[model samples]
Target: MSETRPLLEVSHVSRVIDGKTILDDVSLSLERGDLKVVIGPSGGGKSTLLQCVNFLQVPDSGDVFLDGQSAREMSRRNICEFRQKIGMIFQDFNLFDHLCARDNVAIALQKVKGQKKALARQRAMAELERVGLADKAALYPSQLSGGQKQRVSLARALAMDPMAMLLDEPTSALDPELIGEVLNVIAQLSLSGMTMLMATHQIGFARHLTKEIIFMEAGRVVEAGPPKILEPGGGGRAAEFCAKLAQVTGR
Candidate 1:
């Protein structure tokens, strides 16, 4: 990896789903230890862009580069390896109903990384503790609150020791009161210097932590700059959009 290159870069990426253009030539980059937030109206390509970056939904055009290596050029085996280093957190906590929180976090370690069961469980516990979920490790997802389940999802991602994380509306599914717990963990990760690209509607929280805000609309990046760009009287599309959002959400 070249020191000068971005830790992650999406170059001219586009995605077409069912004859609709979801992302149109979107480009962005994240440097090591940086946190970038994507904020836009619903159906504005925020989630799709994050999915394309992780190759969960492959881009129809352009490419994603990790550590200066092109994702489109990697072999099948290498792609799997590459994905393991980029953690993903989704709006829905994708936990197995049958598995306890610990097992949910440990499964990938055993299945994908081929670690021994005991060691995986140990690491899973440590990650859970990091996310302040150690007490809930033995609980099933059905027994946990929305915030706890999301924290388990965060613990699962952190267990992988990813170089970068892509989060897509991670708090969207939570109740109004539950949102703060998940956001607290995310803020801690940012403070700890974890590189992240997050798509979220929590404009206030994002403005406080993000190094830059990328505003997208209609499948294109409309504006991107420091958080000040979204401030009152900053005079840009991002500022106008955020002002409207604050009015709607009353936050």
Candidate 2:
């Protein structure tokens, strides 16, 4: 892959749930090494779009291509292959309750890459340290703060060394004051040039973090452009959405 080739592409994609259209003819292209932020109101299917890209939720129609190959055409084995290149972080830290943070990060590496226990443990600890949680590696999810747990979740995602990351409202479940710590980790990732697509309402931080902003409504992307072009009060529904988000972000 050349630096300029799109890392992912989507064309005329649609999805439905119980006859209700969730996405309709959505089209998008993601450039390699670009950070893209997706923003939308509640029920707008922003998360669903990410799910489709990961093949967690299949689309009803149209195509999604990663590295120019249609995700829709990929077999189950190939879908797993594709997912290895993508990492996802959810709003709720999905760490296993019975497992400690280190185990949480190690299990995926063991299962996915078939690495031996000693190697996986070493990698997991390194991942934890990167997220500022080296000492907490032995602690279970029940023993950690929400922000700490989310950081562990980030570590688990990063342990895979994915080609791209998809984050779905990563800080939505935290207290207002705690949100910054999680966002700070993400900010560092952005500064490190991680290719990412994040769905979030943190407008001020997002504008500063991402190269482009994508606005979706009713399962369809309605606008996409440089962050400066879509700042609060720029215009249209996207502007209105940004304006509301800005009030929360204190912009």
Candidate 3:
């Protein structure tokens, strides 16, 4: 007999760097198509958790399971394979200034996936179109606004055909006027059944789109529940952050 498990699971994961604990016994689970938001104050380990999940930062101790396979057991090469299944979109956009938007998205497919240049270019254009940037494909990073650059970064991740995505402050670096466009793309991904673990301060988006909201503090997962946990007067630091975000966004 066989039993199926969650698409992603972080169990009792802990990480300490230079005598400071960045993540302490944190755990999370995501079934396929689950969109979970993680929000907290600065230094709360939200970003670190996503890093560990992607294996960009190995935890000091613990296990991460992607689609029921133990990441802990992967060798260096295996770990690389594991990460290809988990896409990461950064706050900084991280696009190469010399690379046009289409190349920025296609380079990974050509280099890592070993696709021919022509095929990679075709797929890259399709992903750019998905993010509403097909026309901008010929543009370079310096020619694009902050939001457009971020969408190009997102397109790069999608071209990898990831099983799930890890987003670290996806819109935090955008201009106030530009944040909505990036959020709209992310909101569509949620509606289209993309499994994602997002660390963000976008409380309004959390309220409407996330299936679960996780709040971390001092490296610990202090609270995790449905969006109702952020209701007025809801107890704890998570609620405090939610309230403050609501006030700032006028939600």
Candidate 4:
């Protein structure tokens, strides 16, 4: 891929489910190191957009290009290879209860990358260190706190050396006090230049760190701009939504 080209592009993408429009001509782009956030009410189509970008939910129309390769064109086998470059982190953490943090991150490395066991473990440890979780590497998911489990999920995503990551309400499942720790890890990733698109209700959090925030509602982008939309009387429906969010979140 050319350095000048965007790392990810969602070009006029649209999707419908059971006769309802889920995404309506949604288009956005992320540069190589850009960290963008998506904000909206529940069921506003933010998660669907991320899924389409990762091809977990294919769009009925339009294209999702990752480093200039269209997801639509990838053959079934090629889709797996293509997805290796796009990491996804979900709210649930999704770590296996049976695996220690180290093994959770290493299994995919060994199975998918064909790395030897020792090499995968070494790399997994490094990713854990990057997320400030190297000390917790031996713990099972159940033994870790919610924040630590989410960090492990981030570490697992990072282990793949993906060019971009899509996070879906990553902190929504965490306890109130644990949210900061997970957000801190994501903030560190942003500062370290990991390209990311996050769908979150954390309006207060995004104001300080994200490069851009796209406010989505009713299956379309209502506002696509900087974080200033959170200011009082910023006045569009997007701004109003953000104000309500700030009041409710106390952020």
Steric clash pairs (candidate 4): none
- Candidate 4, residue 150: how far the Cα is off, in Å: 0.3
lDDT of 3 at 209: 94
What residue pairs are clashing in model 2? none
Ranking the candidates on lDDT from highest down gives 1, 3, 4, 2
Q: What do the candidate models score in CA lDDT, each in turn? A: 0.94, 0.87, 0.92, 0.91
Worst 10 residues of 4 by lDDT: 242-251
Q: Best candidate per lDDT, number?
A: 1
RMSD to the hidden true structure, all candidates: 1.0, 1.5, 1.4, 1.3
lDDT of 2 at 136: 94
Clashes of each: 0, 0, 0, 0
Please write out the lDDT profile of model 3 over residues 156-176, one tens digit for every residue. Answer: 999999999999999999998
Question: Is candidate 1 or 4 superior in TM-score?
Answer: 1
lDDT of 1 by residue, 1-251 (tens): 37789999999999999999999999999999999999998999999999899888899999999999899998889889989999999899888899999999999999999999999999999999999999989999999999999999999998999999999899999999999999999999999989999999999999999889999999999999999999989899999998998888987
lDDT of 1: 0.94
Better of 1 and 2 by lDDT: 1
Pick by TM-score: 1 or 2, better one: 1
Clashing pairs in 1: none
Query: Ten-residue segment with the worst summed lDDT in candidate 3?
Result: 1-10
